[model samples]
Target: MDLDLAQVRAFVLAAEESHFGRAAEALSISQQALSKRIARLEAGLGTALFRRTGHGVEPTGAGDRFLEPARRALAAADRAVAAALDERRPPRVDVWGHLYAPMRTLAQVAAGSGAPPLELGHGRDLPSVAAALLRGDIDAAFGRVHPPLPAGLTHRLVRLEPVDAVLSADHPLADEPALRPGQLRDSVLWTPAALHRLDFLHRFAERFGIRHHAEGTNLGLDGFLADVAADPRRFSLMPADVPLPDDPGIRSVPLVEPTPLYAWSLLWCGGNPRVDALLGALAAEAGRSRWLEYDPAEDWLPEPAGEPA
Candidate 1:
């Protein structure tokens, strides 16, 4: 049956006070109005809820029975409203990346003017991470992107790094100030090719005339260093900002003369918070670092037949 919450509240307060005047004062309504609300509630339930006495009033058996359930209903209503409001509150946007040097740089850039709250998701590579971003499971991801970025999903160039070589310690050119491209022609570059979709890495190997060994992703860092130390003819390319292993068996040197860049970007689907604003801040912040940057307008993807313009 239809029942007013106000009537229920008036009944409860009046029953508790046992005095119509005191209950009215507590409810900020006139004595007549309080009496009328309680009367209406009692009539709806077809029972006498209170009996007038010299002390003012007292609950009937029916009123006492109704009091506990009425209080519970009001408490339930309060909880329902609070839960509804909580559902309407804004969502927390997330920023995700591996904890590499470039990712650290991205964190600084993204914290612009202390804006939209960020949840940092970490230690994942691009393929799985990109899938999550596209599925709206994550807000944004930071990593090097492969070609054919899906429609409606775009990238902002955040950090750019030159390719550095991990060379055998005994290699003749390892002592040079930096490596020139001409010396790279006869070398073979080995990579964790099976672990990622790095089209750019393969293309860079082709453009620089270096043979590439598409090794399986089973090697650990120590194992990789051992492989490098074991061969004078094999070298590996890594992002310049990424830390190299400290080993006397190898030398880490930047590649020069049309230096290949490893570009990282923020990839997102439509309508995300702080993406454009954060990208702008990143551009300004990166200028202070040694890494070169692409214009914010240029998509992170490479230009065909050449470097990003």
Candidate 2:
């Protein structure tokens, strides 16, 4: 019997999720489309693969028998594609949150001797990156991984970066050795985009009772930081390792007492050898730098999604 790989993939995801809606979501297709694919697949096999239940779906005896082989077929297809592309080519990687400089971590990884070459690109956010990963437009991406991640993609926490408050040099709290989240409750939480689009900053503001918020045009990091420096009332959070533009007008104050950590994770579709190499190199670098270190007693993290707390 001839079986379409797309149909096979849809069946596998549906079986894994046990819910057609979620399976469709993971495939980035409509529920109706997913159902049709599976229906066609079942017709080709001449048997029902699934049975509807109150919770979602359960595999029929045939489906239970087919599951492992379907997974192998998908993996083999991925390998064929990877082989055709040529393993010598660097893995194509994209990153989100460019405004915060995700490249710094990648650059650090690349700097290590014997690290594999990488072709880097930029993505707007997690959703966009997830789409690119699904489409095979890119092999992997780096950014903050949050919930509802597309089903086929997988991620691993790479770094936990402590954040600092960016303040104008003349701000009242500027000269303090360090500031706690509570210390900035009265200041405006400056952001480059609307709070809803800036998950990390929004959560930080909500967690700390920083009520005032201001949005500015994002010309780039330099322009954004310059705007932050222009007003003493404006403050923003940034990963401590991100280098500030040389301007005496602004200062980067470490957030202490309960420091907020920005979780960085490497996300990818499985079965890429290059991605495996990159992961290993990143792991070695993280170990050397203690990049994943976290002291829960003294640090604060957003509630765990897929990312490490």
Candidate 3:
């Protein structure tokens, strides 16, 4: 019996996510379709692969045994496809957290004469970027890498950017030279999306005892900054290097006495030569720009999965 790669892929994603709904979303397929593919995969193997739990599904003994091999098989297939494609085609690189403008760093890297040609794209977040990487839709992605990264992906931390608190010029604290996280405790923490989705911001607020939280629709960075500028009680954190809008009403004050640092990492599946070239370029640029500097005693960063690269 032969296995359909599509069915195998669906089974792999389901196993990784534990929840069929989330797996389906990652694969950009309907839950029913994912279920059908998984069922067919199980039938072809003549064994049950998953057992349902109250929360979702868990791989059975057979599935746990098959997991590593399935991953290797997919990697092999991706490599074969890459070999047949036009070698001159630039590697596709995607970015998340567009509000922070990850492209600024990418552009800096690409400006070097030794950098490889790259095709750029945008992803909604880490999950979507992971899905695209596993599918071989993109060669690499740049973003904040959190724990339990998707099964086949690897990452290298590239930069640690200082964060600043942006507020309306008229706010009570706007005149301060610099503010500590504690100073903002009584103010509302405004965000571009819900608190749950913005992990870094959520943790920042929690760590600082900033009790009040508010969210606004993401209407581009300018609009988001405008919203923060419009409310005296609202304040938001932004990467210090990100250029603010020209509006005079916005005041971007540095967060000192433990400046919050946003971590940027490069993620990839590991077989592409172009990925290696890009990584080299990024490493060189990062070193020259002092992009990886961090001092835990004087800076704030969320608990990371691994040491910075």
Which TM-score value belongs to model 1?
0.57
lDDT of 1 by residue, 1-309 (tens): 787988887887787789999989998999999889988888889999999999899999998787766755654454456466664333223443322245556556556553334566653556666545543455566666666664445677656766677789887778887887658778766665442445665666666666545454535566766777777877876666666667898888876665666676667665554355555565676665634554434323244322321
- lDDT by residue (1-309, candidate 3, tens digit) is 887999999998899899999999999999999999999999999999999999999999999998867875776687787688845788899989847889998999999868898999999988888877876778899988887786678899888889999998878999899999999999999888899898899899889999998988998998998888898988999889788879888899999989999998999886666688888888888888998888888988887534555
lDDT: worst 10-residue window of model 1? 300-309
RMSD of 2: 6.9
Off by more than 4 A, model 3: 1-44, 49-72, 84-86, 304-306
TM-scores of all models? 0.57, 0.76, 0.82
Q: Model 3 residue 242 lDDT?
A: 81
lDDT of each: 0.64, 0.86, 0.87
The global Cα lDDT (0 to 1) of model 2 is 0.86
Give the per-residue lDDT digits (tens) of candidate 2, residues 98-139: 467889999999999767899999888898787667656788
C-alpha RMSD between model 3 and the true structure? 4.6
Q: What is the lDDT of residue 4 in candidate 2?
A: 95
Q: How many clashes in each candidate?
A: 0, 0, 0
Stretches of candidate 1 above 4 Å error?
A: 1-102, 107-117, 122-127, 212-223, 274-277, 290-309
Candidate 1 Cα RMSD (Å): 19.3
